[model samples]
Target: MTKSDPNRILRRLPLAVGGLGAVLLLINRLLTPELTESQARGDVVGVILSAVLILTGLIWQQVQPRSPDIVELIGEEGFVLAQDLPEAVKTELAWASHLLLTNTVTRSLIVYYQGKILLRRGILAAKAEVTPGPILKRVLETQKPIYLVALYVYPGRIEFDYLPENTQGVVCQPIGNQGVLILGANAPRSYTKQDEKWIAGIADKLAVTLQE
Candidate 1:
């Protein structure tokens, strides 16, 4: 979509309202009341009509798609993680427990580290997948994040130790670049460009922490 000049719209709104007011005044005078008491109805109609025109003019001026702000979204999601996982992982099982709880995306999230699903968090109760190692390894190689919305992962979504039902959204980021940050939503295509940007920001933060 083409970008809009916000400054131009801001300038036009007042002019549009002034024009609407003039038109409403003309109508109120031209359509005189039959009875003196009915003049109240004209006043009411004028107010309602003026309100509708002003609203219509304002909406017509500011209808455009804007770019998603990624950094802001990252800041919001990162807060969720920092609050959930403040401590370092001691045991692999404990690490898995942390992953499941910290990750709000899927009903469960499995983290594959060092050729194993090191953590599992969420509702699914199944044995680790048969091919998690290869799947995660491939995801690690891609160096980009994957978003899964509405419980369905992409055609080649990395295999997890267990499949999660109602897995609305999935984001797979390579640990090397940034630990994968998956944010889930129930509706399909719920992940917008803004979400990707936010996830990327979170991944970048994780990368810095990992490097340090």
Candidate 2:
């Protein structure tokens, strides 16, 4: 018996796709012999097929999604979680606002001090009063973004009664040990590595800002 290497599959994908594309080209050429110039144009079928095949080949190699560098920056820092302030939390909230303004986040809610939820963009459909302090507490405790799949978890915490019918996703980030930045979208796509980096950068900076 012979042992097979798994990596060989990835290396052979391009060749396999190319071969399949060649067979397709041959079949196409045979079926439409008079359209040689059209086929040669390389703009209609061949080029598209080639590009698709190449991408397919790459996908088979266990291509992982790119994670941004910011994740490491904020994932393990244990600071600013044991204090309360009036002005510091406000600054952090402002910074979180900046983060939401620059991204495609469709909905957001910031909870300050005790549990005061500040509506940034869309409304929250949660049950609680949607305060900023509690949310920030969660972020400080978990250091992870909370992905709200729907509006049933904390209906009072959300103010979704005002948004249009195009709501999608939501994300909340705690920054400056005082402010909570909330983001929402109308589509189902969650945060990406780049998004996380931007959030972490803002959060870390906000933390410093709150300290000062």
TM-score of each: 0.46, 0.41
Where is model 1 poorest over a 10-residue stretch in terms of lDDT? Answer: 71-80
Report the C-alpha lDDT of model 2 over 36-56, residue by residue, as the tens digit. 665578636675787677777
Where does the lowest 10-residue lDDT sum fall in candidate 2? 70-79
Question: lDDT of all predictions, in order shown?
Answer: 0.49, 0.52
Regions of model 1 farther than 4 Å from truth: 1-87, 90-107, 125-130, 133-135, 149-161, 177-184, 204-212
Which parts of model 2 are misplaced by more than 4 Å?
1-99, 107-129, 132-137, 149-167
Give the CA lDDT, 0 to 100, for residue 205 in model 2.
Answer: 71
Give lDDT: candidate 2, residue 43: 36
lDDT of 2 at 132: 36
Q: Taking the tens digit of each residue's C-alpha lDDT, what string does model 1 give over 129-164?
A: 435344445566777665544334355533542444
